[model samples]
Target: MANDTGKTTIDLGNLKAGGFIKERGKDLFTVRLRVPGGRMTVPRLKKIADVAEKFGGEFVHLSVRQSIELININFKDFDAVVAELGEGEQKVASCGARVRVPTACGGCEYNPNGLVDTQRSALEVDEKLFGTPTGHHKFKVGFAGCPFDCPKSATNDVGFQGAIWPELNKDECISCGLCAKSCAEGAITLGADGKPEFHPDACIYCGDCVKVCPTEAWKAAKKGYTVRIGGKWGRHPLVGTLFATFLPEDRVVDFITEVLAWYKEKADGAGRIRIGDIIIKEGTESLLDRLRAGFPDFVVAETIPPQAIATQVGK
Candidate 1:
């Protein structure tokens, strides 16, 4: 039924899904623009500024998920705003219970600490999976170039952090101890024989040793992403647990597809349950079993419980 304003409830819901968020004002909305991987050209950014000045408020809101929200837009100007944005090849971001735009940090292209091409990965995921229906709730994905985790990968539903497992070639070792000196995790230490001793348990896989080894003695044994599943931040935050190590970059999309399949099946008939909650209810082993069928090599055999933060306020 149409409200007194002559718009049905469905109209507002559809607008929300299309990135036109209703504001407290009677007819004002916020128009969110899709900027995948948080990267945009100067010309495109200039276009957004022009659009904001013409159709929106004095300021635009930069969303935490790396989208740009043009504020104080009138519902009547939605079409005009979208058209103007399209002139610059920009598009609207999605909201509601769907896969939102992927967020990422500067990857190996520019960032010195980056171990993988996170920007490329984020763009790929955005192109293939952005705005997919999650059925139960919103799904988030993040890509961190390295363990520095500028994008806070562990706070998303599906998170990927670049990793590198290093190996020492004793034949090339100059015994200069640079590898041990560069290891922040202390995973590498010089033994009595002046050779580097590796403690795998202590390694966070940042590749510092490999980079610092002047003689190329330390090298990457494996380089890929460390996948974490079912993480989220909200009223009740859960830090995602490690699901796979050294997951090949080429297989990320397929891996996510399988994860979504499992989520859809398990979350069926369960109202508004996040992936982490399903894991908590059905147990991590259940999901592991499903993943192992397709990804026996990358999937870890064991996983730790997602850390739950106590967020009860005034209880």
Candidate 2:
């Protein structure tokens, strides 16, 4: 983990090769502060700004998950930076293959496809999944308020979507084509009598038609967060794929925490940072087996799943 002869030294702090470390050199360690749900009150933001100005570079960089990143500091000052960041509040997970930060569409309760608030749960997940690994590359996780990737969750190493199952009310079938139009993926269709019908497989759960339905007929079958894993958007450019269908809010954090630990073991110091390569060569089941070893019920063939092709989220 450390090299004494060369400038590269083992970073006790979760300094990732591709993250703040790459931006600054090996001698300098970078720290990422987790801002749960990518949201912080004005006071927290101010505290972060203060930390960056005093300890790190003059400007603080924002991460894809809405976390805070301060770069270009020597390893000597890294601990002090962390202590300052966690001065009053507990510093959440921000680096090392753990859940990066949380994301929500900022879509409030008024969103039609939603009957729940995903932002709160997204933050909860962030708290539960906070393990930093010292292998391969840095891992990131994200969440969405709806299927719409407001912050491009699909492109992360692990991602979440506020998933809702669409339920079609056969009795209140008034198909004015409004709902169909509202859906970017054409999940809804007009029947013979202009009634609305839905294709479950085709729906991405992006909260689009909820507000458009004047009759309040479009119903969510089940509200939860969908999960995706092993994606990155840099030189490697591998978009994360949808991994799970129904992940309830209470379980999202725990499930993701499990995923990170597994990924760390698989990395094993020689694994690739981009996860698509592993999935393509070793297969998802093989990957899951390494991650979920103890649970007899944890069957990748029956438990874990393959990722679906992502499309038509924000649109």
Candidate 3:
């Protein structure tokens, strides 16, 4: 749309939906690209650099969510910019009330602390759920390969942290006390009889005991994600509460879908309420009851309330 001055009147909502963030300058936008799990190929990155120099500012902005945003792009060059990005197979990210791109840590692929393929899960989520409208507010998801939680999973609306439940086989045990020494949480202690006694309550499920056991006595009885729900980081930062334990990797998508359904239904008419706020208003038990119908085995009967943190300015 053009105005009397012959300047293009852009639809800000439409542009934002297509990842064209309006800049302070007239007719300028920032093109945000989807980089799932923060993984990118060298050639593609080079192409992005070329595109940014040609159609936008000389430098690209790396968003905190791991997206590459081409800054200071003229609205008139939108088509050209998208066309150039397409050649590199780069798609624009979405904004508004939708599922944003997923962030992840380097998972079991190379990180020694990793216990799950978080990168793969992140890519899968981006493929299946990225940009799906949340109906109320923006929803974010993050994946951490293990309890180290390098990705800060608890700050997202839905988070997944890799976990392992270990089991000890007494028959194969060498009783060297290696597992006890390896337990950083002090969940394991050498028993009076020189055997290892595990305190499940203190275990963070990092799998260090299983990894350090020389006799292969400590084995992973279960390996999956510890799910956290209703987390959000903003002015009123709310740390997500544990919702489920050892959720199967294959069932992650289904689990998210169910949670979204509950959020959508519960958050209706609330006017831009986040999932965490809805949980606060409706109570965790309400969502848990709905989730239990589909994920009875994984849903927890009790969970700690989401923590509300005080945000300080100019501190």
TM-score per prediction, in order, is 0.93, 0.71, 0.93
Ranking by lDDT: 3, 1, 2
Candidate 2 lDDT by residue in tens digits, 115-180 = 346667766755554445535666666666666567577766767777677676766656667888
lDDT (Cα, tens digit) per residue for candidate 1, span 87-183: 3488888988888899999899988899999999998998899888989998889999889899999988899999999998899999999888988
RMSD of each: 3.3, 6.9, 2.8
Q: Pick the candidate with the highest lDDT.
A: 3
In order, candidate lDDTs are 0.89, 0.62, 0.90
Model 2 lDDT vs. the true structure? 0.62
> After superposition, which runs of candidate 1 have C-alpha atoms over 4 Å from their true positions?
1-17, 313-315
Give the runs in model 3 whose Cα sits over 4 Å from its true position. Answer: 1-16, 312-315
Clashing pairs in 1: none
Residues 127-190 of candidate 3 have per-residue lDDT tens digits of 9999989899999999999998989999999999999999988889888998998999999999
Per-candidate total of colliding backbone pairs: 0, 3, 0
- TM-score, candidate 1, is 0.93
What RMSD value applies to candidate 2? 6.9
